[model samples]
Each structure stands twice: as structure tokens, then as C-alpha cells.
Target: MKIAIIGGGPGGYVAAIKAAQMGAEVVLIEKEYIGGTCLNTGCIPTKVLLHSTEIYHQLRNEAEDLGLEINDLKVNWRNLLTRKELVATQLVEGVKNILRTMNVEVVRGYAKFTSTKTIEVSLTAGGKRSISFDKAIVATGSKSIIIPVPGHDLEGVITSREAMSLEEIPESICIVGGGVIGVEFANIYSNLGTQITIIEMLPELVANMDQEIVNSLEEALLTKGVKVYKSAKVLRIDRSGKELQVTAQLGDDPFQVIAEKVIMATGRKPSGDGLGLEEIGVKVDRGAIQVDRLFKTDVDNIYAIGDCTGGVQLAHVASASGLMVAELIMGERMAMDFRTIPYCVYTNPELASVGLTERDAVMKGYKIKVGKFPMYGNGKSVITGNVRGMVKIIADENTGEVLGVHIAGNSATELIASGAVAMRLEATVQELITTIYAHPTVGEAIHEAAESVFGRAIHIP
Candidate 1:
């Protein structure tokens, strides 16, 4: 069996490897560098910058409290950029090596479907090649959305990609949109001593996340001297002598923010254009490629996954879908269980969630009970000096089945996996409470939160 995968991203690469492992001849085509935006520009690069800034932030803010004395701490932007590039390059090379080991043919080019089973590649090095395959997978992924506003094309306005590779930290920055991308950049630059102003059109930042956890994050940002403007709309951007002026509307009032640079982190849209998907009888709806439950496109032998499908614009989600599609193509029946997928935000006090939120549970007509345990009550949180958030668990009131787990604190991203596992197995709150959690560990907070649902928590009054 011959398989052709487009877009060498998390989705495409994983599918290629799995299909190869399943004894299919695979060809992976990429226009740009491997590892896609998640590695080259988005997730990995941003995390690298965030990690450096986090260390700097900790030393600058907590050194005195922890009985350490340091002087004249500053950021070396060039060195940081170099390290980010190094990390990304190493990972990209690792992916390439793995693809080679799996014997997946990786073609460097731009791919467009000439027919249901044929893809014409305009090679990056200059010529065109035609690839004929028994099956094809589209994992084109997405790109940052640039809002259509006046003066957006000015020299100082930029996107998340540009924000990651900035030559130096700007004196100040105005970030539009307070979603994951915007809030993360705000956290990064703010910790690095760059004045940050986040303007979110929503009533609250990271509106998709649990609001209580978001409250903690917002509080953390406020404590860091980051200005937040909620329920605001950007009118335009204008130049003002070495700086950029952002005009916005807050309800009935006009608000303005002046900054050295402007970052447009509104969101991302599916990048399914130029692939000739529709020409091949595949449905394209508002830039997103439409796919069925098995990720099969309208064309019987063609499949679409990841950001192109516009289901969840998460790397792990894309990878999972890729794996599932590969199994299906190889004559194995596999299904994607999205309910257990964890959503994470890498902030000072990280945020993570699995399953339904309190609001969603109630809306779905489930009688629920909620339990929360503050991080300050956890010994590890206090020992680690990261007692700023809590663990919230929502369960079915009658059945005691754990419906959702939301966390905000140190290692929250890592800790949320336990919750994902529990939900995946349909574990109840009683089961979680009965589970042993080590003393002086942050995970104990999960246990206490589960106990709190029964009003029998020992850690709190």
C-alpha cells in the first residue's frame, strides 16, 4: 500500500511513521522545515522563551525570600534566541532521523491534489514531482490569524511567530486577544521586564478555560504589573513617533495603549487553501477541511486530520487523530476518544483541565458536585513557593463519577494527567479519594479535593 501525507507537522509525521510501521510505503511532503509550526515556530520556540523567562522571573522575584542574594540580573536576548533555535533544530533533526529510520520517503515541496489519488509537488529546490498513492492524508495544519484592522500592516505590528523571534525585548507591548497564545506571550514578556498590556474582547481572559483557574492566572498577571483590558475591541493601530498607538473601545469609552510593539494573538485559522482539496471533491468549509468520524474526506480514499479539520487545534489532538487514521488505513479499527485529552497552559502557575467544566456539566443537565482545595493547603506547594492556585473537581452528584478536573498551580500540567486517566477509566470521586497520595506532594491536593466533595476533607476546615 502506498500512502502520501501532506504537511510534515505533528499529524503528518506521526501518521507517516505509523503507516510505515504498518507495512505501508509512505511519502511525507513538507513545504517548510520539519516538525511544523509547533516545533519550528509555535509551541517549542515559545516554551523555550517561557522557560528562560520563568527562571529569570523566579530569581528576580523570589531570591530574597529564599535567602539568596543576587545582583544586576538582566536578560540576554541574543543568547536566549540562540538557545531557542538550538532546541528547535535538535528536535527537528530528531524527527527527520526517525522518519529516515522508519523508511518513510519525505518529499520537500508544496503539495496539491491533482486527483483523488495523485498529488503534484512543487519542490522547494525548484522542480515539480508527481506522487501517486493508494491513499492520502491531509494534515495541512493552521496559521496565525491577523485581524483586519486599520494600521495593522505597520512596521511595529506583529504576530506570534514574529513575537518569538524578536531581536530584543521591546520597552512595551500591546497584545491583542487574551487567548492561550496572547496570555502566554504576555506572561513571557512581562516576566522578562517588558511592559505588557493585554486587550481581550471577551469578558475574561482565556474564556475557554475554567474561570476560577483563569481568575488565579489573571491575578498572577496583575501582580506581575501586566495591564489587562477585558471586554475591549481594538479600533486600529497608528504610528506615534517611535512607538505604536493602539486605539480600542471599552464599552462606551475609548481606550488607547501605546507600546513599542503590537502582537496580534487573536487566534489561528485552518490552512487548507492551495491544496486543491475542493477540486478533488473534498469539502472545504471556511478554510477548514471537512472530515467524517474516521477522518475520511468526501473522497473515499482521502483522509484529513489536525488543524485542517478544525476540530481541536492542539498538537496532541492532531497526533492522536493521525495515529487513528493510520490504523484505519492499515485495516485496523481505531477510534479517537477526545474526552480524555488534557488542555494545558504553561504559565507561572500552570493551568490544566480534562473533561467537562462546571458550566458545561450543568448545561448538559448533569447534577454535579464540586470540590476545591487551595494550593496553600498543600505541603509541596508551600515548600516549592508556588501556592497560588487550587484543584477543582466536579462529579456527578448521585453517581460520584468524576466529570472534570481543573488545576492551577505548580506542575498542574503534569498533574492533570492523573485526572485524565481517572476520567478515561470512568473513575469516581470515591475511588480517587481512596487512592494513596504521597505526603508532602502536590498530588495530595487532588485527593483532598475529592474528599472535599463529600465534606470530609482533612486538610481544610
Candidate 2:
């Protein structure tokens, strides 16, 4: 069996490897470097910078409390970005090595479907070629959304990609969106001593998360001196001498903020264009490809996954989708369930969640009970002096079946994995409470929160 995968991202690359492992001859095509945007430009690069900034901030601020005296430590932007680039490059090379080891044929080009089973590849090195495959997978991901506002094309205005590779960190930046990308960049810049002003048209930041977690994140941002403007619409951006002036309307009043740079972190849209998907009879909706439960497109032998499918834009989710599609192609039938997929934001007090939120559970008509334990009650959090959030568990009131878990605190991203496993196994609140959690660990909060469901958390009361 010959399989052709387009877009060499987490979805495409993983699909290729899995298909190869399943005894299929696989060809992976990529236009740019491997590891895709997640490793090259988005997730990995951003996290590298965030990690550096977090360490810088922690050492600078927490050193006194830890009885360590340090002086005049500042961020070296050039060196820091160089390290980020090195990390991304190394990971890309690692992916390439893995693909090579799996014996997946990697074609460097842009793929356009000529027919249901044939595609024309416009080679990046300057030649056109065609290939026919028994099956194909489209994993074309997404690109940053650029909002249309006056003067947006002016100098100093940039997207997340450009923001990551900035020659030097700007003294101040006004981020235009308050979603995950925007808030994360806000934290990154603020931690590095860059004045950050976030202008969000929504009523709150990261509106997709639980309201309580959002509140905690908002409070943390405020404490870090991030100026937040919610429910404000950007009217225009203007070049004012050396700085950029962002004009926004709050209520009936219009105001301006001057910053060295402007970052447009509005969101991302599926990048399914230029591939002739619709021309080949595959369904494309609002820039995203439509796929069935098995990751199969409207066409029988073609499958789509990741950001292109518009189901979930997360990298891990894309990898999971890839694996499921590979299995289906190998004659093992299965469907991908996204309900328990974890969502994480790598902030100082990280935010992570899996399964339904409390609001979602109630909306779905489930009678739910909520258990919340503040991080301050966790011994490890108290010992580390980084207790600024809580762990929340939502369960079916009558059945005690765990419905969801939301966490906002140190190592929250790692802590949410246990919650994900519980949800996947349909584990109940009682089961979680009965599970032993090692003392003085961040994970104990999960246990304490489960106990809190029964109003029996020992730490607080």
C-alpha cells in the first residue's frame, strides 16, 4: 500500500511514521523545514522563550526569598533567540532523523491534487512532478489571523511568527488580542521587562477556559503589571515617530497607547487553500477541511487531520488524529474522540484542563458537583512560594463520575494528565479521592480537590 501525506507537520509526520510502521509505503511532502509550525515557529519556539523568561523572572524576584543574593541579571535577547532557534533546529533535525529511520520517503514540495489519487508537486527547488498514491492524508495546518485595521501594515506591527524572531525585544508592546497566543506573549514580554498592554475585544481573556481559571490568570497578569483593556475594539494603528500608536475604543471613548511594537495575536485560521481540495471534490468549509469520525474526507480513500480539519488546533490532538487515521488505513477501524483531549497554556502559573468545564457540564444537562482546592493549601506550592491558583474538579452529582478537571497553578499542565486519564477511564470522584497522592507534591492538590468535592479536604479545614 502506498500512502502520500501532505504538510509534514505533527499530523502529517506522525501519520507517515505510523503508516510506515503498519507496513505501508509512505511519502511525506513538506514545503518548508520539518517539525512544522508547532516546533519551528509556534509551540516550541514560544515555549523556549517563555522558559527563559520564566527563569529570569523567578531568579530575579524569588532569589531574595530563597536567601540567594544576585545582582544585575538581565535578558540577553540576541543570545536567548539564538538558543530558541537552535532548539527548534535541533528538533527539526530530530524529526527528519525519525522519518528517515522509519523509511518514509520525504518529498520537498507543495502538493496539489490533480485527481482523487494523483497529485502534482511543485518542487520547492524549482521543478514540477506528479505522483499517484493508493491513499492520501491532508494535514495542512493553520496560519496566524491578521485583522484588517488601518495602518496595520506599518513598521513595528507583526504577527506571532515575526514576534518570535524579533531582532531585539521592544521596550513596550501592545498585543491586539487576549486569547491564548496574545496572553502568552503578554506574559513573555512582561516577564522580560517589556511593558505590555493587552487590548482584548472580548469581556475576558482566554474565554474558552473556565471562568474561575480565567479570573485567576487575569489576577496574575494584573499583579505582574500587564495593562489589560477588555471589551475594547481597535480602531486603527498609526506610526508616531519612533513608536506605534494604537487607537482603541472603550465604550464611547477612544484612546491611544504608544508602544515600540504591536503584536497581532488574534487567532489562527486553517490553511487549506491552494491545494485544490474543493476542485478535487473534497469538502472545504470556512478555510477548513471537513472530515468524518475516522478522519476520512468526503472522498473514500482520502483523509484529513489536524488544524486543516478544524476539530482541534492542538499539536498533540493532531498527532492523536494522525495515529487514528493510520490505524484505520491499516484495516483497524476506530474513531477519534476529542472530549478528553488536554489543553495547556505555558504561563508562569500554567493553565491546563481536560474534559468539560463546569459551565459546559451544566449546559449539557448534567447535574454536577464542583471541588476546588487552592494551591496555597498544597504543601509543595507553599514550600515553593508559587501558590496563585487552584485545582477544580467537576463531577456528576449523583453518580460521582468525574466530569472535568481545570487547573491553574505551577505544573498545572503536568497535573492535568492525571485528570485526562481519569476522564478516559470514566473514573469517579471517589476513586480519585481514594487514590494515594505522595505528600508535599503538587499532585496532592488533585487529591485534595477531589476530597473537597465531599467537603473533606484536610489541608484547608
Candidate 3:
């Protein structure tokens, strides 16, 4: 069985590797880099900047309290940018090496379907190459969205991609959209001493996450002197002498923010165009490819995954879909269980969630009991001097089934995996409480939270 995969991103590359391992002839095509947005511009680069800025922030703010005396500390923007590029390049090269070792033919080209079974590629080096396969997977990924506001094309206006590689840090920046991308960039720039003003159209930032945990993050940002304007809509951008002026509206009131640069972290949409999906009878709606639960498209031999499918727009989700599709093609019947997929935001006191949220559980008419353990009460959090969030567990009141877990604190991203595993195994609160967690660890807070579901918490009060 020969498989042709388009877009060589987390989704496409993973599918190619898995298919090749299963004894299929796999060819992976990528127009740009192998790792796509995650390794190139989106996840890896931003996290690199965030980590560097975070260390700087800690030294500047907590040096005295931690019994350390430092004088005249500053951030070297150029060095940080170089490190970010180095990390991304290493990861990209690593993926390429893996693909080669796996014997999956990696092609550098833009791919478009000629028929149901063949794809014609516009080679990056020159000319064209046609590939015939028994099956094809579309993992085209997504691109950042730039709102159609006036003066958006101005010199100072930029998107997340441009923000990553700026010549230097701006004196001030106004970030549009208060979602994950907006908030993460806000944290990164603000920590580097660049004045940040986040303009969110929603009532709060990261509106999709648990509101209680979001409140904690908002407080942290505010304490760092970052300005946040919620329920606000950007009308346009105009020049204000040497800087750019952002005009926005809050309810019926109009206001303006002056910044040296503006970042449009509005969101992202499917990049499914130019794939010849429409011509080949693959259904697409509003630029997103239509796929069923099995990641199968309208054409039986064609499959779609990742952001192009317009489902969860996380790299991990795309990779999971790719694995499932590859297994299915190799005579293994499988389905993706999305319920345990974790959502994470890499901000200070990182936020993560898995399964249903408290509001969603209530809305679904489930009688629930919620347990929360503040980070301040945890020994590890207190010892590290970064106790500013909590672990929340929502369980079925009658069955004690762990319905969801939400966390906002240090290692929250890493710790939330336990919650995801619990939900995946359908573990009850009793099971979590019975499971012993190491002391002097932030994860013990999860045990406390589980115990709290029944008002038996030992750590607090």
C-alpha cells in the first residue's frame, strides 16, 4: 500500500512515519519546513522567547527576596532571537532525519490533487513531480488571521509571525485578540519590559478556559503592569506622530492606545486553499476541509486532519489524528478519543484543562461537585515562591467519576496529563485519592483536590 501525505507538519509527518513503519510506501510533501507552524513559527519559537523572558522577569523581580543581589540586568534581544532560531532549526532537522531513517520519501514541493488517486507537485527546486498513491492524507494546517481593519497594512502593524523575529523589542505594543496567542505574546513582551496593552473583544481573556483560573492569570498580568481591556473591539489603526494609535470601542465608549508596534493575534483559519481539494470532489466549507470521525473526506481514499478539518487547532491533536488515520489505512480499526485531549496555554503560571469544564458540565444537566486546592497550600509551590493558582476538579456528585480537571500554576501543563489520564481511564475521585503522589511535589495538590470533592481534604483547613 502506497500512501501520499501533503503538508509535512505534525499531522502529515507523523502519518508518513507511521504508515512507513507499517510497511507502506509513504511519500511526505512539504512546501516550506518539515515541522510546519509548531516547530517553525508558532509553538517552539514563542515558548523559547517566553522561557528566556521568564528567567529575566524572575531575576529582576525576585532577586532581592531570594537572597540574590544583582545589578543592572538587561535582555539581549538579538541573542534571544538567535537562540529561538537555533532551537527551531534543530527540531526541524531532527524531524527530517527521522523521516529519512524511516525510509519515508520526503519531497519539497507544493501539492495539488490531479485526480482521486494522483497528486501533482510544483517542486521547490524547479519543475514538477506526480505521485500516485492508494490513499492520501491532507494535513494542510492553518495561517494567522488578520482582521480587515483600516491601516492594518501600515508599517508598524504585524502578525504573530512577524512579532517572533522583530529587530528589537518595541517600547510599547497593543495586541489585538485576547485568546491563547494574544495572551502568550502579551506575557512574553510584558516580561521583557515592553509595555503591553491587550485588547480583547470578549468579556475576558482565554474565554474558552475555566473562568476561575483565567481570573488568576489576569491578576498576575495586571500585577506586572500589563494593561488589559476586555469587551473591546478594534475599529482601526492610524499614525500617532512617531507611533501607531489603535482606536477601539468598549460598549458605546471609544478609546485609543498608542504603541510603537501592534500585533494582530486575532486567531487562525484553515489553510486549505490551492490543494485542488474542491476540484477533486473533497468537500470544503469556509476554507476548512470536511472530514468524518475517521478523518475520511468525501472521497473514500482521501483523508483530512488537523487545523484544516477545523476541529481542535493544537499540534498534538493533529498528530493524534495522523496516527489514527495511518493505523486505519494499515488494516487496524481505530478511532480518536478526543475527550482526553488537553488544552494548554504557556503563560506565567501555565493554564491547562482536560475533559469538560464546570460550566459545560452544569449546562449539560449533570449534578456536579467541584473541589479546589489553592497552590499557596502546596509545599512545593510555596517553596518555589510561585504560589498563585490552583487545581480544580469537577466530579459527578453521585458516581464520584472525575469529569474534568483544570489547573493554573507552575508545571500546570505537565501536571494536567495526570488529569487527562484519569479521565481517559474513567477513574473516580476515590481512585485518584487512593493513588499516592510524591510529597514535596506540586502534583500532590491533585490528590488534595480529589479529596476535596467529598469535603475530606487534608491539606487545607
The TM-scores, one per candidate, come to 0.99, 0.98, 0.99
Looking at model 2, the pairs that clash are none
lDDT by residue for model 2 over 165-187, one digit each (tens)? 88887899999999999989998
Model 1 TM:
0.99
Global lDDT for candidate 3? 0.94
Query: Which digits, one per residue and each the tens of the lDDT, describe model 1 over residues 322-398?
Result: 99999999999786678998999999889999999999999999999999999999999998899999999999999
List the lowest-lDDT window of 10 residues for candidate 3: 333-342
TM-score of structure candidate 2: 0.98
Query: Per-residue lDDT tens digits of candidate 3, residues 300-385?
Result: 99999999998989999999999999999999976667999999999998999998899999999999999999999999998888
Task: Give the better candidate number (2 or 3) by lDDT.
Answer: 3
